[model samples]
Each structure stands twice: as structure tokens, then as C-alpha cells.
Target: MITLLLMMGTVSLSVAQVSESTLIRCASTEQDSLRISKNPALFKLRQQSEAVIQQYISRSRVNKRTNADEIVTIPVVVHVIHSEEGRSMGGAGNANITDAQVNSQIEVLNEDYSNTSGYKGFYTDSLGVDTGIRFKLVTIVRTYNSKSQFSPITDGDDLAEISPAWSTNRYLNIWVCRLNDRYLGTSQFPVVTEINNRTQGLATSEDEEQDALTDGVIIDFRYFGRNAEAITSRIYNLGRTTTHEVGHWLGLIHIWGDRNCGTDHCEDTPPAYTKNETTDIECTPVFSDCRGVNTRNMIENYMDYSPDACMSVFTNDQMERMHAVLELSPRRAKLVEFSKITTDELLVDIYPNPVQETLFSSIFTPNFEVFTVSVFNQRGQKVIQDKLNRTSLNVKNLPSGLYFYKVETASKTLTRKFYVR
Candidate 1:
């Protein structure tokens, strides 16, 4: 049973009934509705974002810009919120989880997004597509809080006040704590206007700052980390809970569409009514639906409300939608851009590594007016030079061999090696 928390001019938030309850897998959709109620403009911004995504999808068919080979790394900031008793890391049943446990969760995220084999996240299903996205742990902040547990609906603002997010536009801030035991996790959807320079310039400063205190993902500490059976539930210890919540963070809806026989906006995934039909705890394959027609429920999809062990894939269309969000959504796009430029090395991901005719680059730097790309042969002789007004560079003239490229920006210059085939 779900209880609603009422607040002035805010949407009601549903809280879990009791401790150790696994009925609620995620609260993102609920949180999103609440956010919309608080700020009606957010809904309009999301619709605008959807329009941009549709345009991106139409263009990607010809350019293949969202290719899986071009990886986008998002920097992560983990805030460990623990009780006074759970002050130290790595004790039996400690809320301040160990570094090893944290790193294990990161490993699971990379494996699941990359579709790495020999892991619980890997699947043999043809619908499964590599997302070409990666997460890097930049910093972990541990705070000792007096509260023993947090409620995703009511206590979210309190938690944020205790340990605030690091620039939401740049880093993916994740809070790990002992939740009310009903939910595994929750996340905030990306807001396009807050990140997009064009729309942001037109909006008031107050409106732009509306969501600053409430961006990123929240996870129950017990359900986090891989092989955490010693402290977590046997049904959810494999670290797939984080995977499912992160899918919501990336703009993918529940595979069941959060309604009766509704659509998840992806045609590849079969229609499912599990969102309203019932909470799914079984791994067995079954045919079910809302209307008279029946279709196999996609229990294997990461966005579904299934047991951790049963979830695996994100379909091709889902992959496209996520990639589009990363590209068109300014906050997400800038997160990738910030990751590339903020480091000491001024890192950039250029692909295909062994280029054929065209070479692509990640958003190299933000606010840099002009930059130059220079290429040299194996003998260190300059072969190609051009001003990079966009993310792609033409290497069709270069012969099939190893080459090196240097990107010069106003702030710094970075050189990396690549190949032409």
C-alpha cells in the first residue's frame, strides 16, 4: 500500500508502507510528476526537448552520429549519507558502505551500459543494444546524518540540504542511504531549458535555479553495490537496482509504459500492462496484456519492474532515445562536454579509432570560440589541418595508416593518437 504526502502547491508523494518491503522498485515517475506540479514550465520544456529529440533521431539515420563506438563518459559524485552508528565504512551492516562496494556498483554500471559479457547485465537477446555510455567516479562525499533512514518523497529535500549536489550540469550526483525499505531508488529527469543556452537566456534567473537543489539519482544503500548479499536482499543484491534507476535518469520510461497496455515509445519492446496489472517478482516468461490481445512481457528489459537477476536488455529504440537525450539535452550534453574538458589532461574521445573516411570527436570544450585540429603521419609530418567548427573531421584524404591528431583550444592543447583504415 502507498501513502501520499501532501504539501502546498506540490504533487502528492507516495511513501512505502513498511521496512523490508520490495513492492516499490523505483519512485522516479512519481518524483517526476511532483516536480512537474511544482513547476508547470518543466512540462513544456520537456515537450520542447522531445521535439528536438525527434529531429535528432531523424538526422542520426543519415549521419550515424549516435554511433555506439563514440563513448560519452559522465563524471559521478557519490554522496554517502549514513547514521551515527554506521559512521565507519565496511562493518557488517554499515550504512557507510566501503570503497570496494562503491567501486563494484560502478563496475556494474559500465558492464550493463556497455553490454559486457560474462556478467549478470549481459544478455543474448537480439534486441539488446550497447548504449556506448560510461560512468567515472570522480569523488565520494560521506556525511554522518542523525536520521537513520530517508524517504524518497518527503525527505529528499532534507537530504539535499545536508549534502548538496555538485554542479548538476557537470556531474551526476548520486545519494546512497538507508531508504524507507520500500523503494530501491529514484532519479530526476534532465531539464532541457536549464541546460540549453538558447532557452536559458530567455528565462528568468529564478526559474533557471528552480531545479538546482533536486537533480541526479537517489539509491537505498542496501540495494547498491554488487554481491552485497551480506547486507542486501538476495533478490536485489546483483546491483541491477541502480541500473534500472539510472535508466530513468537517462530518459527511458518503464517498459510497461506506466499504464494499462500503454506504450513505452519504443516499438521494438512488446506492449506490457505490468505497470498497472501488478508488481512483477517472477523471472518466468509469460504472455500478458491489458486488453484482449496478449504479448510477452519484456521482463529482460532494465526499465521493467522485475527481479534484479531477470533484467538485462535495453532495446535499440531505447538506446536511440537515450543517446538522443545525451546529445540534445543541454545538461546531459554539457555533462559529457564537461567531463572531456575539466580534467587536467583535457581528454577527448575520437572515433572510429581506425577511421575510414570521416572522424568524429566528443564535445571537446565548452565556450571556446575557435579551435584547430592538426593531423600528422607516423613519421610526425603534418598531413591535415582544419578549423573544427563542428564535432566531425574529414580524414578521407589520408591513406590507411597510423596517425596522430592535436586539438588546440584557447585554454589548452591536447594531442592523441588515432588510425586511418
Candidate 2:
């Protein structure tokens, strides 16, 4: 059983297998309520942050200093938690997502946030602005545990102790696992407030330290990456679940604002009369009005509850809001600044591509003692699998064709495509 303390009231949900047609809860509002309940003072802090963000947005509009040209790269760490049984099953089933699946999600993030996604041309009427934000994988932390399901209500405390968040000031931590209550994902927003009259401005270092421990995104493994084998839902198979959760991590709220005709604080987004229903499968247009002004809902917004196929854009105003949070929030500012650390260290190179015989591999980092290599054919069949105590791999007897290789280390997983002629 999963229970959530929503912003308005308490709600209990009986756990069940989430069908593809069932609605997926973004869970940001429930998460926000829980955080504020833990520290009631956060309520005031969030309000202050919102006010400041609006001011920043206004200033940018007038001065034409939107900072849209300045690209902000966020370093990400994906923590994949799975049980022994799930790991043995493998092949993107449930908790056992492949390394290529993880990287595929990252590629989707880069494309979506940069406005270069393949679906961009589909939403021509209201093509959203590029937020100038890009995500790069810094590390992957894989854990094998006995637990099958982690509680989203508990903020994933069960596995967090084992795979604790890496310095939030530098990396955007994402925990991927099986979630109870059929939730797709959840995220922690940036909320900063002045402590006392003595402090000059912004939140105190003590506040940031406390928030850093829970500062990240949590996703259900089944809905995480863009592999068909991992994601069985045709509506959500494109890996947009993480895209939506990351939007919350960057301080975005639901398009409906968790209320009837409430504002998401973005001027460009049309007022939504209510939350988009999960069964509204065909990207059906919705019309509504706020204060007597007629408007059409932007069900395509990433922050909405619309299906993945229906989601496509983030408005110009939404991009400015995220940029403001990145600039004004101290912890968020530190994230962008500290991400300059060398991410190239995580790169793994596989040599002798299109080879007829032996294939050699080398990792740039010395932290890993051993590596696990798996080769999958174009048909998604694992043809070669081995545990490596050294860097070289022998693929002499494999059938000739295009193949994908996944290299797994203690702290990271790297995937690349190769050809065996």
C-alpha cells in the first residue's frame, strides 16, 4: 500500500501493477507537501522563491537579458537499483535495464531540452523555446538488492542509504528503480530562503546541506529509457518520463498547477481547466477559459499529465523560469558551476570496430577493478557475454553484422555501437 499526503489532503492508494493505459502520477505536488510537512518553514521559502523567479522573468523580458544563449550543462548520475532476480532476467525487463537503455534516455534529454528532438516539427503551431540546457552522464551507480519495490512516498530512503546522492552542487542525481503505487517518477525542487536578518541574502549553507541529501530525481526503471524491450507502453516508449521529472527538478510545476484553472506561472501556456486525464490518448485538443478569457490548453507541455506521444514543448516563459531558478538558487547556481569538472573521464573506448577477429576495450578511469562486457546483435539478442579481468575482448566467431556493446564497471556503464564483419 502507498499513501500520499497531497497539498490539499491525505490520499491512500492500493498498490497494483500500472497498466500502460493507466494514468502516471508525476508526484511533485505530493513530494512538495511531504517536504513542507517535514519542515513547515519551507512553505514560506517556496513562496519567496516563486516571487523572486517572477521578478527575474520580468527583468529578463524588459532588458532582453534572457540568458537563452548561455548554455548550461548539468552533470547527471543515474543510480539503477535492482533485485537479484530482476538482474538475472536481464534484457531491459523491469529493473534490469541495459547500459544502452540508460544512455538512450540521456540522448533524449539532450535532444528535448535543446529543441532538436525528432518530434519538434510535429508541434509547429506552438513550438517551444530551447532552454539552452543539456545533460551529460557523469556516472552510473548500479546496485543489487533484495527489495523489489521502493516507496516514492518515503522519498526512496530504502536504497538512498546504499547509493547516497553524490554532491548535489555538482551532479543531478537520478535514482532508477521499481516504484510502488504505480508512480512513474518524482523530483525535488529548488527552494531557497533567507535565514535571518544577519544573513545577507539567499538560503544559508545549512539549508543547502539539508536539501542536498534529497536533491535529485527518482524514476521507475520500466519507464526510464527509450528501449522497446524496457518500455512496453506504446504511448510512453519514447523515454519522456525522465524528461518530465527533470522539468520538476528544474522548478517547473504541473500545467494545471494541481488545481482547477490554476496557473503554472508561465504566460505562454494556456490555462488548463483541469489536469489532463490519462485516457485522453489521442492528443485531443482541450479548450478552457480563465477569468473570462478563452484559451486552449497546452496538453503538449512536458509538465502536463498528457501521454508521452502528446508531450513536446516547453514555452519561452517556462525556459526563463528554469533559467531564473538556475541563477538565483544558490544550490542550483553551484550545480552549473561545478559541472565543469571533467566528464571525459567516464568515457570508454572500444577498438577494432567492423572487425573480423579480436576486439579490445579501454576505460579512461582507473577506479574500476573489473569490467563486464555484453554484445547484442541488431535483433536485440545477446550473442556474446563475458566478464573481463582485463581490457581485451575476443569476438572472432560471432556472425558478421552491426552489434551493440555494453561495458559495465563498478561505478559506471558505457555503451557503444560497433560492426563485426
Candidate 3:
């Protein structure tokens, strides 16, 4: 029998290690960093890997990835592993970072990724360019208690996943947790890396784990920083941290281009990396520390190594590169595939919800797999016939109009409509 390997299906977190029944309870605790130390194995491994990666970068010369579109929408799971304090708000001078902070971060991400207020002279042409990237803070807290069942604390993005390590096509997966060993956050290397979760080298893919544990991004409660765990009223706001990490998640190389600027493939971003600085510095605009000429320095971009407040703008070239990345990367294209959607049988799906030309679906569930989905125009003409996983017909040839779709995956199949603008 041919079987489907799904990431984010079921993952049993070692919750017992921290001696907490709920993740929310755990995140609320005000543990000192001195008290908590990094796991020897993870620390050593990260160190060694980073060093080797640097060497590899020096040996090879490739353009750095600094574009936003290259990184598709990565589904994020924010684990608000609270401590005993339970949404502990240490108010006043040390008032805890409230749920307001969490919501604010989500808002910020939306505004930032959507490039709403962001297109102000940040790019080279100085004209506002919209970055077609979306960041959704998942409302579901996909956690596994001792019982091996999904815990109920999911409070971020609620877009339920079939598993972890999504197709890398339609959606990017992110897990926000405080469970790592003294680290703020970490992510898997995109495609063709020793860290390939599918091979179980560094991280495990969702398909390999057979649960919902492997698909999304994980941010720690303690360092998810301003978002969920401002419990101590202490906001260790590192704007570039999330921006930087997400850049990596989206497959953008550092603006400084790792060892030198020539390796990462970004001609515009120069090599001006400071090993580890606590504060943001004034960098050269179009500065070419490594490569010469017309360099934008690009340090101020979200993908660069600048501070959060300092980072702004995504170049048009970056947008094109990101699209190119989408075309070439398999995991990226999987976002639109049926393999990522959940099969509760009740979840509704609309093909061409934002239909450019045509739409398709192969929705199969426990209740119904061979159901019919009808398409209707504003005039309500049944214009199309579609069978899930049956054919790849041409819908693009159709005229632009308000179209409705009716699909049946299981017990009760229904219809939904969208316009083909």
C-alpha cells in the first residue's frame, strides 16, 4: 500500500523534563539564564556545524538570498509554554509582557511581511514595493502531553496541519517554543542540507515523526521575547532576531554573505557582519566591504544583520529571486498540494479562492474521496467538472468572473465561491 508521510502529525514533546503539566504553566516561570544552560550536544553540534558551514561558504561563491518572495508563507505554531505564574504579569517597572505584547508582535509581523507600512523608500528605487509574503501566527498550540494527544494550548495560528514538515510548497512551518536548551530559537536548513529532517540528521521531518510535531516553526516562550512570554514584564526585544531567523527560514543568506559577501549570491548586500553586537550600528548605505560598487549595504533590510528597528525594505530583485526559489524548491511548491491539509472531513476548501485563471483540488478524506465539486459564475453557469486527483485540466482559459465552488470530501460536501479577477 502506498502511504503518505506527514510532518506535524503527532509529536511527543519531552514535557516531563521540565516537570510541568502544561506548556503555558512552564512559560510563565521566571528562570534565570544562568540557571539554565545549553544542552552540551546541541551547543557543540551547532558550533561545529556553523564552523564547517562557514568553511563551505568560503570555498564556494554563490549569491546570497535576500529576497522575501523566495520564502513562502511559513505556518507558525507559537507555543506559549507558561510557567507556574499562568500569564504572569509582573507589572510596573518589571511588569510582565502581557498578551497584548503577543498580539502586537503578530500585528507587527503581519504589517511587516505584508509590506503594508514598510514600502517607504526602503528599497533602492526608493519606490514602495510590496512583498508578497504572509506571516500567520497560528492559533493552535500543537503540543503533546504524556497522553500522546494534542494539548489544548494552541493559541497562535489555527490553520490545522496534516503534519509537520509541510510540503515546503504552499506553507512554511514554524514552531515557537521555549523548550530548546538555553537557546532563543533555531530552524532547519532549507533543502539539500545535512539538517534535512527527512533524513533525520539534525532535525526530524514531520513525515518521519508521524505527528504534527515536525511541520511548523518553534519559538521559545522565554525568548519568543515580546510576543507570548513577556511574563516578567521584561521585554528582551530583539527585532532582528525573528527577522533574521525568518530570513534563514525563507532561505535568504546573511547580507554579509557569511565568510565573505561573494558566497550568499546577493550582489546588493555587502559584507559588513559584526560577529555579535548587542546594539545596532550605523552601517554604510550601498557599502561594499567585500564586493565593490552600487552596493546598498542591505544591512537595514529584514534579511540583513541590522537591528529590528533599523531593518526595513525588500529590493525588487529580492522579490524576483524569492519567486525563483519557489519555482525551484519542492518543499515550497507543496504549500498548494492536498497533502498538507488536515482530513477531519469537516474542514472546507475552495479551489481558486483567489482564482487568477483556474483552480484544482484533490481533497480526499475519511468520509468521501470521489465527490463532485461544481463551479458557478455570477450568472451561475456550471462551467467546470473536477475530480480530486483525477486530472489537471486548464482553468486559466476561462474568463474572469465571480465563481463559486462546491466540493465533497466526506459526509457533507458543500459549495463556496470566489472571483477570478
Candidate 4:
């Protein structure tokens, strides 16, 4: 079962939009800086998370076993919040995206992250590695709002105003809607802290609940998925907006590091004087920075602000840094574990027809080694699956539909039907 909050009283404010020629306007670092300033305690947490990553990197250099080659699968849930007019209009209009468009974006993510795309031939010698990260679509949510566009004083506030997210520790929640501004996308970085006695080191719950309302990505519907209609801009139509934002989500800073000759914490990516040349889809010319060092910048790196067609690689150091975040960050680690958990457990009850917020299930026993619960749609397709160690499952994010659930224990499997209204 899920909790729904209705927001009252909205203030509309005007802001600058992105230029028509710009490829992507990622506001992740800007949003993160604001959050750290407002909550000073997060400064220390950020320091701690960085320290862990540095230590992990140092150890990996000395010991080969420090980092494993296991692929990380991240569950995704897209929240499509559209105006009634947009919903009625449908197709590729603003705030009105089709399911195929969403799936195309996911396909792009898998290809780019795995380096399996047809454009892999463009990878330069500087290309170092594949991030070994993959995404799975867990569900899709559609919401209706009268507001044509949403602008958050903070991205967190905007998420709360539109749709509440699923468990951030378990799933990546993406909010796709019409933006009053010109930004293509924004994302939240991983943070380390403790929450409710749980090791939510990567992302704390209180901050995620209040300051960061939802911990994931927010994309403009026009640039969300790859399709002729949704591809409002020729340069950004390849579904790389979500790809770039997810890089930030997984701790990959811009290749230029958002500063002149700044460090992106990766050794392989050459230092750039600035990210000014990223607006174009062509290869950048060789240039020297303040250090008088001249070299051709890796304009093709995904972390750069380059157009989707010009981006292709994640250097070895970048992959190592992201893998470290996955292994050392507690919340991220737990999420991976929860995703891999599977078993058979006896279920006693799944109650309350026309489920309002959360759905509750009573287990016959709690001593099973591994118990799993999953939900399926009327078509018998598995829509939601997670370790059911607790008595409740959040269904608030589920659209109004008929669904069935199966509980698996060591000795028995139980199935039930429920509806969300």
C-alpha cells in the first residue's frame, strides 16, 4: 500500500528556459549544492561517502579481489504526471508520453551502459570500460494534474507536489512531466547516513523524505524517451537525457567537473578548461587549459554535456568509482540485496478490496530464510517483485487496476487478488 498526499496552494514563478541549441541542461550539481548548504549536516555525510570511495579505490589498486564483476540491476518506476488536457491530447505532446517512448529510453540505458549499442565503433582509444549497470522497468504510473507545468523551488518539493515516490532504497523513481523551465533533466546524488536504525548510508530517509522528497531523476517529457514525436529536439532525441541524469544519480560528475580544470574524481578523463564546447554534437578541437597542457578532450564521454549522438564512453576510473558507490553505499547495497532476494513463503491474508494506500499481507510464519512477494497485473505479467520481510507493501504508486500477488516461502506459495482504486 502507498500513501498519497494532496498538495494545496501553489505559487507560479517564472524562470529562464534552456536555449533551443543546447543539448542537455542537467541541474544535479546545482541541486546538490543547494541541499548541502541548507542541511549542513549533509556536508559531513558527503565527506564520509567520498572517503569511503577513495579508500575503496586505493584498495582496489592493491588488491584485485576488492572489486567484483557482478552486474548491478536497478529497478525503475516512471511517474508520468500530465495535465488533463495533455492526457486527452496524448501522443508526443508535452507531459503526454506513450509507453513505447518510456521503453525506448530504457533500451537506450541498457545499450549505453553495457557498451552494446551499434555506435560502439565510435568509441575512442581513451574509452576505458563499461559501467556494468543495467535497468529494469518495474512499473509505470500515470497521474492527472491541472497544472500545465511544474517548477520546484527545489526538485524535492516538486516531486512531492506531483507524485510521491516508491521506496528509494529499493527502486529508482523517475518523474516525467512538463517543465516550466528549459532544463532537460535533473538528478539527486547518492548520500551516506543512518535512518531509523537501518544502514541507509548511501541515502538517508529523513533527508530523502523532507529535503530530497524523492531520490531519483526528473526529466522533461519531451526529451524523456526516443521516438519521432517525443524527440522535440534533434540533438537530444536519442534518450541520453535520462542516461546523463542517471550518471549523476550513480555518482558520476560531469567530465569537466563543473569547474575550470576541475577534477571529476576520475583519472582518465582529460581536464577541460570549461564545458562550453559541450553544446555542439561535433568533436571538440584540441585546446590548452590554465596549466598550458594541450590535449583533445574526451568530448564523447557520457559525463560531458555533449549531445546524445556524440556521447559513448565511461572511462575505467568512472566505472570503478560507480562500482565503489554500489558496494560501499549501504542503501545501494541493500537495494541490490533486496532485488536478488527470492524464495517461497506462506502467506496468510491479502486484504481490503479497493486498496486505498498500502496493501497488507500476513505471513503464516516469519522464520523463513528468504521470503519473497510479487504482484502481477490482470494479464498475468509480473509487475512488482521484492523481498517481503515485512507485513506491508506500498501500492499507492500503482495505478487504479486489478492485480494479483504471490507470496513464496520455503515450503509453500500463496497467491491472491486485489484491486487498487
Q: What is the C-alpha local distance difference test score of candidate 1?
A: 0.70
Q: Write the per-residue lDDT of candidate 2 for residues 1-421, one digit (tens) a residue.
A: 3433232111112222446666465776887788789788889878888998898788988998967788999878898887645356345345767778889999989888987775632343465778899998877888876666677657555556657765554568899887766678888888754323221112333434345566789988778878647675666677788999999988898888889889889877888888776755578777788779888778788888777777779888889889988877765775665544455345555665666666654344333234577889988898877654333446778888899888776877778998888
Task: List, residue by residue over 150-228, the lDDT tens digit for candidate 1.
Answer: 7776566777777876556566779998776377789877655434333221122344443555578899887888765
Ranking by lDDT: 2, 1, 4, 3
Question: What number of clashing residue pairs does each candidate have, in the order they appear?
Answer: 0, 0, 81, 19
Give candidate 4's TM-score: 0.74
Listing every candidate in turn, what is its Cα RMSD in Å to the true structure after a full C-alpha superposition?
Answer: 13.6, 15.4, 15.1, 9.6
The runs of at least 3 residues in candidate 4 whose Cα sits more than 4 Å from the true structure, single-residue gaps closed, are 1-18, 22-24, 66-68, 120-128, 193-197, 200-208, 276-279, 346-421
lDDT of 3: 0.41
Best candidate per TM-score, number? 4
164: Cα error in model 2, Å = 0.9
Q: Report every candidate's CA lDDT.
A: 0.70, 0.71, 0.41, 0.69
Candidate 1 TM-score to native: 0.72
TM-score for all models, in order of appearance: 0.72, 0.73, 0.48, 0.74
TM-score ranking from best candidate downward: 4, 2, 1, 3
